[model samples]
Target: MNHPNMKKDQPVTLQTFKKGDKYHHKIVVEEAGYINDVIFRLGRETPGSYNGQQITVNYEEQGGALVGTVKYPAHNKVIHNTYEMDGQNLAKTSECEGVVHKRWYNKQQN
Candidate 1:
């Protein structure tokens, strides 16, 4: 559970939406500040999709990684995500059900 590659101050957000027959996942963070406020606000303001599933969201720290968990009880799905940020490089690992997904992203230099 300890992720030494992550940073404590930066929080990560993970989102999954089911469209058609597949679930699309997205993990993102704000470049300037934490994304907690924006994510919560959008979640509340956004209308539910056709799936009509209810989800519970929580946040915690695992080592230096910022962990986010979202539970979809209606579909018996739970996703746990931990993210690491090193300068402009971002990496995330998401576990849902029994599948694990890892990805790396590099921010474009401006």
Candidate 2:
């Protein structure tokens, strides 16, 4: 329904959600191609439930302007604190003894 070239910062990966309502967020940008930039490693239940000490991965596709990376759960390891987009989104966040996660990516530049 939405993919008119689908630009506007695209990084998506929020699988299986039903907490309240609004579901579906399984995006792995790159014009549906695939060339690195994909991650989603967090598992206390899911992304935010993984803890939350500031995790901001914005892929604003309502218009355009997105960057990636920002994770910190140091101890086991998951610290790449910040790297705004295409620095590789810091391994796709969520890994301090992760709990099954891996589905995130961003790609859209014109």
Which structure among the candidates has the greatest lDDT? 1
**lDDT score of residue 106 within candidate 1:** 62
Clashing pairs in 2: 41-94, 68-85
RMSD of candidates 1 onward, in order: 13.3, 13.2
Residue-level lDDT tens digits of model 2 in 1-110: 15566566665442322334332234344564533222333222123312324332322212222222334334334422212234543224332344534334544344
lDDT of 2 at 87: 56
lDDT of each: 0.56, 0.35
Superposed Cα deviation of residue 26, candidate 1 (Å) = 8.7
53: Cα error in model 1, Å: 3.8
The digit string of per-residue lDDT tens for model 1 on 19-105 reads 664334454555433222213221222222222456666555567666677677678887887777767676788999789999766
Tell me how far the alpha carbon of residue 10 in candidate 2 is from the true structure, in angstroms, after superposition: 11
Worst 10 residues of 1 by lDDT: 41-50
lDDT, candidate 2, at 79: 29
